[model samples]
Target: MQETHDINIIAWWGALLSTFLALVKLWELWNDRFRIDIGYNFTGAPDIGNEIFVRNLSSKPIILSYWELLYGSGKWPFRKLEEIESPGPDACDIRIDPHSSKTFTFAEENYFDWGLKTLKGRKIYMRLYVAGRRPVVKKLYG
Candidate 1:
């Protein structure tokens, strides 16, 4: 009789453990995973600085793979000003924590030769490629 009771208790514990593990897996599957958002930061005063904000709204961390900014002429037959390419591989690869935001400042110093004065009062378009996701594009005033 004791042996039968011992077997029954072992089986009961085994079933309970399996159920707990299954619930944990289900909970993980239900949450969002690997997603991010990108947008431009407008401070109204252009001379101060221009920046782009990227928010990681996912359960797991992510890396920024590539990005580019194309200045728009804001009119018919729009022309594209100097394109901003991603920095070096080490610099371009940014590790963003889950549910966090990061800001990337524009390289304003290089604009002297490229006519930063003319590029002002125009629209700028930015494209970003995050890890394991489709490319994202956004428009902002330069």
Candidate 2:
């Protein structure tokens, strides 16, 4: 009778652990379901600077707080500017609705002001982030 009780207790513990693990996995899935998706477009290279457009293709709203531009060669990377360095506003907080888009006008003059040389024939990279979200980076070679 004691052996049967011990087996029952062990089985109960095992079932409880399994249930807890399943709950944790479900929570992770729920969090991921709400995360936003960003889509990048290399519009064109007009002479001033590269034109790039960013859009939120996810089904949820995203709050864009900050973004950075990186220009470099080989393996060495350098940061060009942030939203603070640009014109639109000092605070980079912009809310994007689902399937909506926003255009950012980045000029070569801004890069020169940041002490970076002309982006002609150079590889330019971009890294943008939404508030309380991960950073998305993209590279464009012209």
Which residue runs does candidate 1 get wrong by more than 4 Å? 1-34, 43-47, 72-82, 88-90, 107-122
lDDT tens per residue, model 1, 28-114: 877775655667654434365567788888888888788777666645566555575456456567788889988877545522222
| TM per prediction | 0.52, 0.49
- In the range 1-142, model 2's lDDT, one tens digit per residue, is 9999999999999999999999999987776464443333443343455455667766778887876656545543653432323334476588888777777765555532222245544556667677776886666443
Pick by lDDT: which candidate is best?
1
Minimal lDDT window, size 10, model 1: 107-116
lDDT of 1: 0.69
lDDT of each: 0.69, 0.61
In model 2, the clashing pairs are: none
